[model samples]
Target: MTCFPVVCEVESVMLEMQDPKTGVKSQPQRLVITTIPHAITGEDIVAWLTNCYSIEAEEAWALGTMLVAFGYIYPLQDHKRLVIKPDASLYRFQTPYFWPAQQWPVEDTDYAIYLAKRNIRKKGTLELYEQVQYNSLHKWMNHKWDFIVMQAKEQYRAGKERKKPDRVVFDCQERAYWVVHRPPPGTVSAMDYGLERMVDPNTEELLFSCLFSLFSSLVKYSVTYNKHDPFLAPCLPSNPWVTDDVTYWLLNMANVEIPTKMRVERWTFSFGELLSDPRGRDDFRLFLKKEFSGENLAFWEACEDLKWGTAATMNDKAQQVYKTFLTRGAPRWINIDGKTMEVTVKGLKHPHRYVLDAAQTHIFMLMKKDSFGRYLKSPVFKDTQKRAILTTVENAQSKMGIIILKRRPSISPIIVRQLEQEERARMATSGPVDITQVMSKLSNKGKEVPPSKK
Candidate 1:
């Protein structure tokens, strides 16, 4: 799998932060319970980021929090909150082995082993989340519970031999890693790639209901789109491939002045389908104009252009979008919620292609929910539907005579050469042949054959 670019960049920054001479100063720091060696305060981390990148303190703090959240830097004291405190709270650069760029699979067996070791150390005093996971894993891996305990015991014994400071630091490092990976329930994990399930799979009833719902949705979708699917339904007029007619292609051109009845029918299938077709979007734009909310569609289209357009003009286009639609008192202002506005405005300060995503999504949902439904009911759609062209086989045949299905045959040169050689041999053999020559040829064939085995 391809690695995320941010992960690679974070790893590089981490390497610079680990430089002995130019890195954040570290020394033995006393925690509430113990003294951890080579620990740096959270203030030092934020300051180092600000000075190194020449950014504002807020941006530096955000970057530092990202580093901590991604498991590159782990807090030595407050392992629960993974953010730079901008104070004297102790933190440390995580060992490279535990960095997320390693792409290690956070497995249950490894977590079980760690929990078992912690159980032994704390004497059954693991935290609430850890305790819950331990019980679940125990039930799941009951067959190999004994083996897990044995491995955990061996690891704990080995850890006992390490120096006091080293052991404490390692313990804190491992704990921080797990806290990021298996965060308390209800909290979003930074390591999550958005594919995590929302419902528990172990509940049979819920799982069956989810499966049934998904199957129902599939059936409904197939039924709704059955006629629109070209492979499932015959193309109007005639299939271009089979009939060798270009009329179908001409009629279905993306920006055709007037779409066919079938194409207009497809627009009602979904909002996405309507927006995907140029003609449909034009019709939607017309409806939005009548409603005085055309800026929403304009902003959505600008965002799409920014996302897919050339990278060289990305920053300029982002600025243009902000000035045109997002800025207060702008000509074409779009309405979005305050929270989304804050996020979009803050992200625009360090603008990339997706800086306007939150606002764009908010507008897209607004249009989809409110404007899209109205557009279907509005006379604009009905007018377009009424004016849509209807082409039939008879009309096509009358306009452009019966399309002859031409079959063009292609022959390989090698086959032609082989046939030529066979013909030459046939011509040579067509004439009378000498019996002595035939005998000599048979003798040659016999000589060419290998001697028979004994």
Candidate 2:
């Protein structure tokens, strides 16, 4: 007779009994079971049952089911776990075959299109969304959105929590934007590079409005004249830097003081530095307004804001932006040059997300060359500069009080002479003097001398 020792701990015991009416009785059998250790796998337990217990295949299977039900064993989810010996063919960077199947499972790609569409719709990528929705999945279809979905799905299937996008789809309404190509892994799309996304929506809207007002006037000027001037300068008087509810609302949202610290010293900063500080940029906009060329700065800033705004609001913002800044006579127009303006205006008819690139670039260059230098020399800016320096001096003085030596109350002649005598006496004696004898002599002399009463 052969004996097999079961290597398992008993988890639970149950008694079998008979049903009264049907008279069906079950045997009260003692079932001795084994529990799998945490470190051991289901296959290991099965092998243990076969080798140690020497059980028949059927009995081993029966025990296997019970072990699995008791949470004592589990099947490996990673297909690679089955491969005892991994070879070069087992793992490849492009594609690997852990299973016997010659082809790796083509991850269900049907949702790729739908997910891309939904993402485009969510992000306001109208051209891409429409392309994916109406057209076949081709090279032109925005692969970046599809890639994001694939990565997200892969992460989820791998037991990682799904990731959400932290960036906005579009930061500016005026600029037409589209994803041209799929970005490499670990890099942002080309459209997103060097663009601001996180901005106050109200500020974005106000900037759009300002640009619209400027461009609308330009378009009106263009239609009346047959020969549109390429280098038309703004001749209008400067508009006061308007502070309506929008400005206050945005400030409150940011929890920052108005015309922030940077705004006060706008004249001293370069255009690049001004771009980083919203308040400084705003002050520069006021200078541009004074020059009657505020539209250039407004359009550029609006584009930046929209570029960095949440990705979801891009489409509608883009449309409104196009109508306002690019379209002829649209409200709050950015007065771009004729050739560029015409190109932008035509592009607006079939606006893709990046259609405003030429115009934005033109305006950026225009502002950098023209308004920036003049801004430094502008009377308003110079005045502000003077006030800034004065304010700085005053603030410093207040923070750190000035110390002045009051003319030492002129020392009395007698006290000065006594102090000199004391200094000489101290210098002459190296050892300690007997003060008791000196004091007695002085008192005796004082008593002998007649006292002069004043």
Candidate 3:
């Protein structure tokens, strides 16, 4: 089966603290976590978010903006009252991003909504706890988050089993924070990247030291982003780098940190680096002027386009410059067939020949699941992992428990890995249209998928 890893960026930082607490300045720490099946997705997560956040339209907007301003992404939520345990992290991350909480399988969503509608008559549809179906589902739903507790009580008949009866206490009310607290505007601290700031010592003086270090760590023969190589990967804490094994491989990789003296002196990525900010960032745009003729016009243009945090793509020219520097000290035009998603590796070839350390990769996947939760859907993976994911999925699905393939497999993980280094000589390069969907198909090949053609 033809296959490769599903690599993409996932949101890492979350907004929790407000006002005096000032949530973490926020840094993107590289991590990996397990992908959960879709079974846990439901309204409990949604209800918790509503319970946690301010239901006021402006209140939610200010809250969401506070998060985005600190350099993490958050979405808008509509204002409504009567939310249940809103402090839940699942709801905090998913709600603003357009994930529908009510669509979740949890009946608590209906109950929560019922509680929110102040206009509903008390004895009508709004009368909660009386509905049979709602009560049943709510009871089951509540158990999902219920903590296991053991309690012991003393009995009058001493000496037998310590004369105590074990009892369990349900402290749901204490842990379930039903009330939402709305602080003033910019409730969360407008701090710098926390995780990086802790490590860098001078996160502000330097621009992207952590980022440069990470990219630098793996690139031995090359310099910057390789459009074909996974080295120049999408930025985020988890799956920052792409992988070939949809099961374990990843695309996680970036960060900010104290500017090294060298970075402070030479590579400071100031607001001026790509912006029109009066502090001088806008000057980077001078290359676009008719009179400017000192350096690379196209390269400089790319930098300017992304000055306001637009984001980076693998094949951009500046990254090409950096990658070119890393490889053979220069970039060269390689033969490429975009349609085929293939390219020839000359001296400047990049697709980072980097793979996570086995233990590190494993740890990273676990962490990724913590953030994206149920959105992730792969299993454990290794650089040596090479079952074409789909083949495994297909094998599991074969009605006879056996499926024949057009090609016999005989490559070692090591050999398969080395081949990944081969610069395909194709004049074109094209990846699967929908990498995630392709991954799902590969993982569930012949297995049972309600939506699958099988």
What CA root-mean-square deviation does each model show from the true structure?
A: 22.2, 28.0, 33.7
| Candidate topping TM-score | 1
Q: Weakest 10 consecutive residues, lDDT, candidate 3?
A: 145-154
Task: Please report the TM-score between candidate 1 and the true structure.
Answer: 0.46
Candidate 1: residue 390 lDDT (0-100): 91
lDDT of 3 by residue, 36-112 (tens): 21111113333323355637544454444443333233312221221322232221222332211112232344333
- For residue 266, model 3's alpha carbon misses the true position, in angstroms, by 35
lDDT of 2 by residue, 1-454 (tens): 1111221232211100012333112222211232211122334444445655689755655665443322222222222122211111111110112111122232324334434434444574434444454344434434233333444344334432322210110111001111112222343332232122112335656578668899998787575431213244211111112211133234323224344232444325456766666656766778877777776776786677666677677666677787767676866777677766665665556545555667787887777787778877888666555553222334433333321132134689999999999999887696667899899999998889676899
What lDDT score belongs to each candidate, Candidate 1 first? Answer: 0.84, 0.44, 0.29
Better of 1 and 2 by TM-score: 1
Comparing 1 with 3 on lDDT, the higher-scoring candidate is 1
For all candidates, the clash counts are: 0, 30, 58
TM-scores of all predicted structures = 0.46, 0.30, 0.13
- Summed over model 1, clashes come to 0
Alpha-carbon lDDT of model 1: 0.84
